[model samples]
Target: MNHTTFETPVVSRARTVERLVAGQPTSDGAGVKLTRVLTNTLQRRLDPFLMLDAFGSDNPGDYIAGFPDHPHRGFETITYMIAGRMRHRDSAGHEGLLSNGGVQWMTAGRGVIHSELPEQEEGRMEGFQLWLNLPAKDKMRDPWYRDIPSGEIPEFTRDGVQVRVIAGASHGVPGAVQRDQTEPLYLDLHLEPGARFEQTLDPALNAFVYVYRGGLSIGDTAVPVQRMALLANGGDTQGIVLQAGEQPTRALLIAGRPLNEPIAQYGPFVMNTRDQLMQAVEDFQNGKLA
Candidate 1:
């Protein structure tokens, strides 16, 4: 892992916690138990970010079947593996094994068929899959994929807090992945007891924090494990202040610039209009989606 110090930004008006959300328990992709944190309903509220699913389980039955072949279009999928092993195969001829602390980023531009299956029989499988939408102009471009290993990610430590820059810039360090359409910022933070951290934000971006382990607080709101705090935007809110409680904590802070464009989605296909979505469905059913 690489380490670098950074000059902390000043937070004149720290953003407050808009609301705390408990993840809805759900099973997906052949009965893989997981929590659907960011659902379809919040798509407009969290524009450019379509969905966020957090999956973790120790039982082989929970994730063994994995995700069979599927099709996706008009978006990108960022799968961050926190533990266990999984293999990815796609119609774009992309293949990779995702282990602990790795990230698999795939752009289903135009469209692509893919499958993700666990390589482990037991142990623990934990990770998150975040769907990021693309602009209309780039939606039908060539497909792309990348498997970022654990060692390739960048991180920094300060005052008992560890920050992983997954996407966008953090402090003075740029993340492993960047996008101009959304300008998404994704960070995994691990904090020791009583630790505090801060980060600056643009007022135009929408953001949220998901606590996966231990507990933390944002502006008097107690965000327990498995909860997400939707950060308030606009006005004088320019940054965020996070304080861990008596126990160590781990969380993902995600923010992104809104596209402010029309959104039409059907199952896995997301497009800018209803006609486009229908076209995607026809393409998939007519054996031409990939």
Candidate 2:
């Protein structure tokens, strides 16, 4: 595991932010067709966390054709379900079901083969899967998995806003999902119209907010859907002020201390050095780690 201390400071004050430029959608030929919305692959707004895929389908035909077994290494894949259910099976002898508001956090350290299939017979399905990179020292470690049930997550109301701590802290609540690095925070925040929500964050951390469901205002700026707003680091202040619009709004706020290391990536693997990346490819090809 990485043992480096975070060099950034806590954010004290942030400006009402502007929106991230529009990004194009790309296709991933997993068993079920997947489209990446606000991902680093398309928009390099967020590093370390590389991609975010929001997949959904109401017809059984769209979801029933699930992802078959595939190999992954050098990174983590976190799946958060908002609706329907999914069945996960991996080569590590791990299998489970993830329902609405549940999470499946898988660390493909050295390597792992896994598949994700829908378990619901009917109704619309919606969820998001995010890809996070592992540092060089921890890349070859043993694979691990965390299955967080919906009820296991912490939820609370501040003023009139509802906050869900999925993988980080918010409003004095921390997430249940554990990470090798302690510098990151992930939150799912929902707010009613005419509400105000404010939370403190480490200024040393790199942060970005993605507007997923509804319109929101950071200070005085309005953020629309499918766009990201980058937050300014606080020099001595404690947090940012969030003001909800007249209508309800939802957004994802993610922050992590920057790795500040060179990145060499090929396909699904990311490494600090090209030599290590080549060895990873060979290991996968020779079936030594797959």
Candidate 3:
């Protein structure tokens, strides 16, 4: 018999919130209203993470048309639903429904065309879409998709704090969605009033937190809904501590290993160089990109 043991080092130092950026109101994909939290203008791309968009609206007029067919390559798209439902159909003949608490991870390696539309005619629709950059070597790989339901996602609770592990380990429990290339961490945290949550992270990775509900204090700095806090590099220490205010709070913690490579982006195509970007354009124009 063989035995394996995993251990996480205890670090006393905590990573502090470096900066806060307010989300910008924007519209995209057949006129769906969204708040762009992270954009190229913010930091000229945050290593492996390209963009984060939060789409939430109770009025059907704000999101009725939904995202029409679009093509993408050399990256991945992650859709996590907090409310309502979205139906997705891709060129690879894959279809999925992302309901409240559901998630869809789509890897547009070489190319892919997809559409996301609301499942209901009227009501609330709310969710997030994140774009992750792929390494140059894996840019031309085959497309892949992973759809995970809310129940399948692992959750852990302790001391009035609950954490849903979406794409990495939390409290010794691993998430359902794992990608070998980027090795990202996505966590949804809910903190009861006056509760505190803490976690250790990889020092080499880039990390950020997005507050969606209530208020939280990140190392003495107060953060509210629709605001994003970018964390400083851990350096010698790789831990973060967050405390909830009087009201209950909800936030997302995301981190990813940095690729540290040149980026060339054009609309839906992201590549390593101008030539590659031009090739991607030609591929889509000739119908080679699906």
Candidate with best TM-score: 1
Whole-model Cα lDDT per candidate? 0.93, 0.74, 0.87
Q: Single out the weakest 10-residue window by summed lDDT for candidate 1.
A: 1-10
RMSD of each: 0.9, 5.2, 3.2
Candidate 2: pairs in clash? 8-204, 9-203, 9-204, 10-202, 10-203, 11-203, 12-234, 12-237, 12-238
TM-score of each: 0.98, 0.87, 0.95
Candidate 1 residues 1-290, lDDT tens each? 66676777888789998888888999988999999999988999889899999999888999999999999999999999999999999998999999999999999999999999999988999999999999989899899999999888899999899999999987888899999889999999999999998999998899999999999999889999999999988897778999999999999999999999889999989999999999999999998975
lDDT of 1: 0.93
RMSD after Cα superposition, model 2: 5.2
Q: Relative to the unseen true structure, what is the C-alpha lDDT of residue 101 in candidate 1, on a scale of 0 to 100? A: 98
- The local lDDT score (0 to 100) that residue 139 gets in candidate 1 is 93
Which pairs of residues collide in candidate 3? 112-290, 113-290
Report the lDDT tens digits of candidate 3 across residue range 244-273.
Answer: 999999999998888888888999999999
